[model samples]
Target: MYESFFGLAREPFSVAPDPRFLYLSKQHRDALGYLNYGLRRAGGFVLLTGEIGAGKTTVWRAFLEQLPPRLDVAYVVNPKMSVQALLKRLCESLQVELPADADRPGAEADLIDALHGHLLLAHAQGRRTLVVVDEAQALALPVLEQLRLLTNLVTNEDKLVQVLLIGQPELRQLLEHPEMAPVAQRIVARFHLQTLSRDETEAYLVHRLTVAGLTGPLPFEDEAIRRIHRLCRGTPRRINVLCDRAMTLAAERGQLRVDRALVDQAASQVFDLPGLRRVGPGQAARWVAGGAAAVLAVFALTRLLPPWQTAGATVAAASTPSTASAPSSPSAPVSAVPASALAATAVPPSPSAGKHVASAASPASPPPVTASAAPLPHGLQPYDSQAEAGDTLASQVFGQHLPESEAWTRLARRWNPAFTPTADPCAELPRQGLRCHSSQGGLGPVRLLDRPGWLLLTGPDGRSTRVLLEGLQGDQARLSLANGRTLTVPLLKIAPWWQGEFHTLWRSPPAYAGDGVLAADGASGTWLAQQLARLDGGPAQDGAEGLALRIRAFQMAQGLRPDGLPGPLTLMRLNHATGVSEPTLAGSAAAR
Candidate 1:
């Protein structure tokens, strides 16, 4: 109704996930990057959670559009299906043929077989299969278990099917349940979408209006924007609802622009508040006249008081909250909902709230490693809630990579004095000639080490999962999983969850009792120069000054402390950069 009044071509505040009006905030961009990482992985699980109406669907749609043609995607918008029903749906999605003569169990078997065949064909053709289950939080435990079992269908190196699960914040909690560890352990990439910030919310509104063919200034007054933001709490859906109602009310009042009064009146109507009733223009005029008279009376009374009393009265008046408007706070980007807005009241906080705060980082104190991304090793998958893959992790790190169950079997058979099996995989790394080093700030130190390793990903419940780092490619890292998949994640995405701990296998360095010096014309310095030159594509030189500058420059490139000294972190990275071939006794510890 307000489209023509505001000179818009169409409704600007529709609550549809229209890609045309979608705006990518920083969080959204991060979420998309995670999604892309999931897609690039061979096959595993990608878990995405958000509060209701945080634009998960919009981001999903945008991601789907950009997916490569080699990937075939099947979307499950409703996840409340039985195992058999889900199997049938999967068959329908993948276009697998099912025979009519089969019973429910038989049909399920048929569907699985057909899907396996189809996926194998796709694999042979160098294609990929993805099944996206939306509203996954509502999936039954049995069905989730069934989905986990489906991931068991794999080649020696990759899973036949990749699953993408999208749901609300509740899904995160659901995954934290001990019963869901099997499913939870498969998630290689997880990202939670947050609500828009105040600025993003304002930009979202303007972007919508412009998309709806409004080329002039925004129809909303500055005060109206603040009122809307306060009521909507930076949620795009609620913002749209309040804005739509505000515009409707404005059109009803025959106004060309929406102001604070219209927004308040619209909020009252939208929220059904008993104290805030919509009034007519005549009533508003009378209220303004009455307020003016009251102000004049107060001014006269204040004039009779002493100067200090008058100033005190002025301060008190300023302290009073105005019903007409709210002073906008310094725009906080966090997702918060004030109780005044009925719609926003339904939106929950993002899972892992405030975990993304960059300010929590300190240079001296690094974060802890809380999560891991090791995929399910075959033969030893944890079917029970209490089962820990500690023995398997030991085998993967120390012994050869065996399937989870097989790894346990191998651990028992090849038990060595150095290997003590425990439920916690990372409990006893020191015995295996390895050490766990943690840095607080970021990946600069990790990159300086530059070795394939595992990260302990901490969940909200304090349980840690292991994430495997296969290699680093510039600013991103190639992470391998137990499910035979590899994810290329940007360092920025990892920063949010990285607790600053670097855990991997490192050989003990030879004893050297000198100040950490890596640049000189000596044997060690010449080797360091040659390694740095080879690693960085520069000319090999052994001069102390030139090599020190090169070392500093290399440190800077890896996001590490760029001090000129080739410290332990730099030496470790250089040792890894140069393959371990005929290593000098002192430098041999740096080799993986």
Candidate 2:
């Protein structure tokens, strides 16, 4: 309706998946890169997940528009079907002709044979076949198992079919089901597409408007756009819904531009709120009035969202009664609710006790992974009943609480199998082709470093305890304790107690000795120069050419101090950037 008045070719804020309007924000770009990389591989699954309106479907469509010229795609838009129905749909999507007898509902074997034959023919003709599933979280276990079975249809040098699964964050959780292990193991690439940032939110509007043929300045004022970001938390679809309404309101009022007041007015109408505050997805409209204090507490406590190693799918959670008590072991159910749904943190007293934390990520919980090993020492559980009173696992005073040696050993095992429990684990690293790295920072930098590490969580008293942060996804953290027990907890509860100290292990580069300063004329320096060149897209050098300056520049960019030394942490980051083969968090390890 406002297109003519705004001088636009089309509606700028339609909630549709159009490739032209795909804004290449850093997260989007990261996801797109993984999609492109997944397509290049011969076989395996490419899993992409996000919130309902987080632009996952849009990214998948963009991937389609950029499909390899020689690809045969079997796209399943809705995967909530029986295993037989799923197989039939894949056949229909890929144009694989079904036999007359295959019309029977129970002819799954025949359906599989037909699909295998079609894939083989396609492969022989030098074509790649890919199966793409949307809303994959709705898929049944047998359906998922069938998808894994499809991956087994292979010849030498390549599998006959490659699959891409796109769904909400729970799809990530669903894959973690122990029964889904076969399919989980085949995921070659996985990325949790997150919402845009504040800057990207603004740019998203500009890009959409520009694509819709706007030649004039933006219709929404700066304050208006910022307000929209706060309300929508940078979710693209929510941005579209709000902006569409705001523009329509402006157009009706015969105004050329929108302001903060106009945006708030639009939000009130679109979200139907008397006062429009930060409207998180899945949050109730009632929260706009009663949730302010709780929102502030949780927002300020703003827990560490690990680099989407979100359960690195298990990073998800839900609500419970005051009587909820956690199981003594990881094997038993923590609650009727999954671990992802349960907030491990103390709920700061709220005006309405019925409300949950607004900032808490609401990924659907999958079945908790059952640990066959021993439980937390003395039956200490992951979710404590006293957590609401600030007595979480980290805050507990257990008689058999893990000592530093065991913590160091658990941390060491990620890198070195032979690593033993010791007070000085750093001294044991050199002999294991590894190096010890420590740093103090918030979760963002540690996530940027993106290596699993040991977190020193202190209790109410002055004493500290060691916990292994093996997986981090959104707001859920999978922590390993001394007895080899693992459990997922909300980062919200843990963030307040942390004072920013951590230690991780990194593999040193070739010809690099575990020693003091890396000499400029030494082999290590030459290797560092080449790695830097790979990242900087510059020339590789055997001789020093402003090598110290290059190292310092790299350090500063990576949030490290501007020291020229090539420390183990810096090198590990370089390895990550250059796509070196190394162990990642559990969430990303399988995909890598």
Model 1 regions more than 4 Å off: 102-106, 273-303, 306-309, 313-592
Model 2 CA lDDT for position 64: 77
Evaluated with lDDT, which candidate comes out highest? 2
Across 514-573, the per-residue lDDT of candidate 2 in tens digits comes to: 774566667777787788777554457745646765665565445455566776666776
- Candidate 1, residues 62-163, lDDT tens digits: the string is 777666668888888789888888887887888877667445554677777878898888888988888899989999999888888888899877888889
TM-score of each: 0.52, 0.50
The local lDDT score (0 to 100) that residue 243 gets in candidate 2 is 96
- Candidate 2's error at 153, in angstroms? 0.5
Error of 1 at 256 (Å): 2.2
* Residue 109, model 2, lDDT: 95
